[model samples]
Target: MNGHALELGGIEKRFGKQTILKGIDIEARPGEFIALVGPSGCGKSTLLRIVAGLESPDAGRIRSGDRELGELPAAKRDVAMVFQSYALYPHLTAAQNIAVPLVMRRLSGWQRLPLIGRWLTPRATRDEIHARVRQVAEQLEIAHLLDRKPAKMSGGQRQRVALARAMVRDPRVFLMDEPLSNLDANLRVHTRSEIVALQRRTGVTTLYVTHDQAEALSMADRVAVMIQGCLLQLDTPQRIYQDPRHLEVARFIGTPRINQLDARVDDEGVAWVDGTALARCAEPPRDRKVVLAIRPPALHLVAEHHPRGLTAWVKRCEYLGTECLLHLELESDATPLIASLTPELGTAYRPDQRVWVAAEPSQTLIFARSGERLTAAEPRLERSANQPEKLDV
Candidate 1:
């Protein structure tokens, strides 16, 4: 079955005095994999529940293709949700679990009983259900485990059973709410690739919810970042990382977190950090304070006393074999800064060692006092007389 496009308009959810979602809007093209990601309590899961018809929105509407799903119960939405808990029955075998949807949907009430139901059910209908279950099991490579109950299966195997159950329906849309969260780290990584491949092969319109930013960035065609009940940005992984529209979006998408420094725009339209002029703002706020955000990779360690460089004392270092992260305390403003370096280069620095940090202006992000990103009309950097030459380390 082909996937259907999903559209969510003006989606709002509230619980008494608290609002969980605030007028969210999103559209997924047919067969697209969209990841909804945010920190805990950010309402990403609530939004996914709304899409699955498991939770009702106080306002807004959900549509799949031309059909509006606002009034449909969870069973009638033509959507299949693979929940985080696997939700497998302990007594049911894998094949039985996978066949539940079909059995419930296709069988009469009398045909659902134990021994009598099997005889009462049509021979053709029973064969079709069994054949479909086997097909799903084979596709998931779990045919051997069909006889094993969930109690005997591993987490990943049980997760596959959950997926197989969802796949058996061949629903128009797939909703996964942290389906891999229960897996161990290595298994989670392996299953991530498997899930992406499965989605591509099935071509199902999928909405995956997770609190892991890395998972969202690595697996999804597009990612929606929500925070405090608001959808902050929705775009490809590259754009979400490189061209975030808001300060909160910038702060949430990257590892080690983006560095924030207090900065100001001078009367001459130049942005300065710790008395060092870094770049020219497109629309400078005269003598107004602002926040400058720089990604860890964009900040390079330079030799001590480099011109226009900010002096920092290394407070700690974390070596991750492939690379090293230096935690620094800037002397000028006492702001914490982190710089990622190749292991070879990072090993040369030790705690309490003083160094200089410089940011590539083009990669730097400027935010207004209100926490909105400032767009540069022109390139942010202006060739400065004291600008340090590119460093090797």
Candidate 2:
């Protein structure tokens, strides 16, 4: 534990003409878990790599605790990276893999000798190394699999080995770049909990990068949503979901994303989607259209002509075990909007069923055409969802 455990100030990176990380800035306190989330190729992994000293930033300073890592090599930074591919040496057994970091740091080049240095060097440090390896293996529940090589272990097991290797170093910060990507869906869920538990036990400040919104939302203390080389929103998981700063953040966080209804702000500062007034919002620019983002579960089916209800055309409906999803092809666009409905209520729904969808005035978000979100603007309609800028995904 230390002050400003990790910080990246004005970080910028470019690959040729393509700018990957544009002035990225973030901080992780001791014991903090900050997730870096984004769409594929949005520079999330690149940012993590830059922080790990694996990739150099064209600009900006990377710091871990009190030391500046600008001139330091990866080994000198005391930062450990648990890679997406596991990156375990297939020839080495699990124990050997976990011992690699300790071996590199503690043993002199010749001290790694098979017979000479092993018998001649000090024994106290070698015993400490064994104890440290055992501690991490026990923590990760890989003690039984210590002798198995990467080729014999499952993806989840391999992931644990990678984590244990990083753990043995007891670094100031742990940088994990999509460490769960290779596991099966069920295994991913299981491993995620394990990772969270391990982080708690070790109290290591972590920067976890992933493209999966659910992974970030469930695991992170705060999530930073990146897009096109910029971080659009960073907030608690619940805040990111309920109040998004940008339309792109709103569209990226949820299971089915959010349903956007085409609407225009009238002179009276009211927004009317299709033929119904969704909310009373301040008049946006005359020619620009506002997108009303409503969470699927936020709206309910109401009686036709009911106050604040929306008329939607149901295109397809899917029945999941506990809930059903209503896919409606809005008249505004070709993309079919999805709404998650509970099975208890989905009993009344059907394909091609015309339904009235509506939410409270405070449940919808209005956005400008360019994805710039306007939250404080006076609402013009009765059902507008007024929100503060946030990112949940």
Candidate 3:
């Protein structure tokens, strides 16, 4: 690893009366890739700017290793930032752009003049900077385009130039703000893997900000889900998606989005949705309103009138090659839900078809009305000596 651990504590920011960031805290271990993800205006970008020294926090401490970064100017922060715009100088060639940081940091005032600069600068310093530029450009596969200016390059090429520029500095931290958002869909996917590989090879601590959950989940070692100025959960990508600690995190993370149904947990700790029993709470709370979050893939269609399923009417059926998506509405409450099924399993289902929707007990997530996830367990099915099976709903 070639970087230092970056830490933020009690980070707060505001503009006039509107608070942009709440008491935010995050720590990125050396060489770790952390993605900051949220909807627009969620303070993700503000936090990144704070760390880069472009925007100062109203109250907080920013540190890398044992050094405090709060008071340092942006130029002195020893961090490289790749902006969404690619921010390449239109007038400069790719090689010059990649060497800008070294030129500024290594050459003196008189040594940087265009015409006389070459003569004033020592050959060794110039050669060293040139060699570094070539090395990084080659590493990024942009060596062939070194003499081309930004205006003549494609979006992906310019993006590579920007990345090479950042990597050439060998900064203690890398701050990237939606750097791949401008690329085409296929290119975005390809570039994502490249960036991940590059980060691993260089071992630079990175904080990437993106609104695309797919990008965040696929590329980051850890994901920080921020919402309405608060960082709700920070954990491994799998844990963030599968074991979200908060309801908002659950709702914001999945594709086709997680289905949320209105329900209430009875005094028996069993949650009920429209008269059908759902999951049970690990520790029962008094009768209270709760929400059940189930992913599309967690839901399955059963035969109509099945005892263990909720009655639903399919509103629409989308056939997507290998899989199918059935959009359904509960018969009792008309709550909207989606279920994922294999093509063979869903081919017979049509719009307006009546079916039963059932979720795996272990896959159902229960959350309080206040947006906190409640510990979930399987609801017990009781059968006394002479009585038939009955659910503790």
Candidate 4:
């Protein structure tokens, strides 16, 4: 926890009888970017609001550095939020909107008057406010568009202005909820890179929420995957994709997603589908149903059919410019299998053509019927030497 700038411990949120978030925990270090990602109804946005103080949790604690911000208002928490909508004033120019935060903080309580505020402005305070606004606008690269209103600017420009407003306050942390959502695909990619660069430049801890796994995978220092109001797994993008804790995380984090296949385990811990045994298998209950997952990229089409793998028939071919995605249907179970390759059509097989799909034993992942992941481990015995516990027991 020493390195963490924002910590949400055992956070639970509910509305009457409905639970939106259930015992969620997240940690973001100083100058670190964290992405909260889940499906549309999985409460990712609600959790962000809790961190922003826009929504209060039913139970649990949220802390920043050494201070516990359990119930602090948004203004008092020294945290800034940029919403997806940007929420800018249509009448105020970008510079005016950016300057509003500085004005509120620097001006005297009575000097906030629109017309007479100029008269009461202390010269030093006015200069400080203007300097701060100009500095943030320049940092955000919106100095050229400062005189334009929200309607007159592009979507990306408006987002920059909103960020400038947030940054003008020099907040310790930033809370962004789908800030790139409103932009088009190309612009979204550009803005995502900009936001990541800005976070690094400002050195502000940020908590971002989005349903896009690609966005989370590409930009976040750590990605937290939530499902049904519970945090499923939190790890780096590579770990979340390669070493998922369970079957659901494996399916949700990838682009085309990993294939989850039904399998049967024999009495000797060997996995089988229609009497064909797979090698290097993890041990599960004898004669129990299990799940075998192989990512699309891990499987290959073989010329000779063997007893080790299942036989599949090509159902459809989809060309996605970079690769040809072949949808293969298993002959025995009729399960759909997907294989992607770099536009290499070896035989020009038509639909319903038989193809032998094979994957190495190390590439396959096995999960129990209960959705618990199985990892290969060697059996070792350990005695509690210090505790004096008997190994026989």
**Full-model lDDT for every candidate:** 0.88, 0.83, 0.89, 0.81
Q: In model 4, which regions exceed 4 Å deviation?
A: 1-4, 279-287, 345-347, 377-393
Compose the digit string of candidate 3's lDDT tens values, residues 332-380. Answer: 7688999988988877888888889888778889888889889887668
What TM-score does each of the candidates earn? Answer: 0.94, 0.92, 0.95, 0.90
What is the C-alpha RMSD, rounded to one decimal, of candidate 3?
A: 2.8
Off by over 4 Å in 3: 284-287, 305-307, 382-393
Worst 10 residues of 4 by lDDT: 384-393
Total backbone collisions, model 1 = 0
Error at 250, model 3, angstroms: 0.6
**For model 3, what is the alpha-carbon lDDT of residue 32?**
93
The positional error of residue 296 in candidate 4, measured at the CA in angstroms, is 0.8
Q: Could you tell which candidate, 1 or 2, scores higher by lDDT?
A: 1
Lowest-sum lDDT 10-residue window in model 1: 384-393
Off by over 4 Å in 1: 285-287, 304-307, 377-393
Predicted model with the maximum lDDT: 3
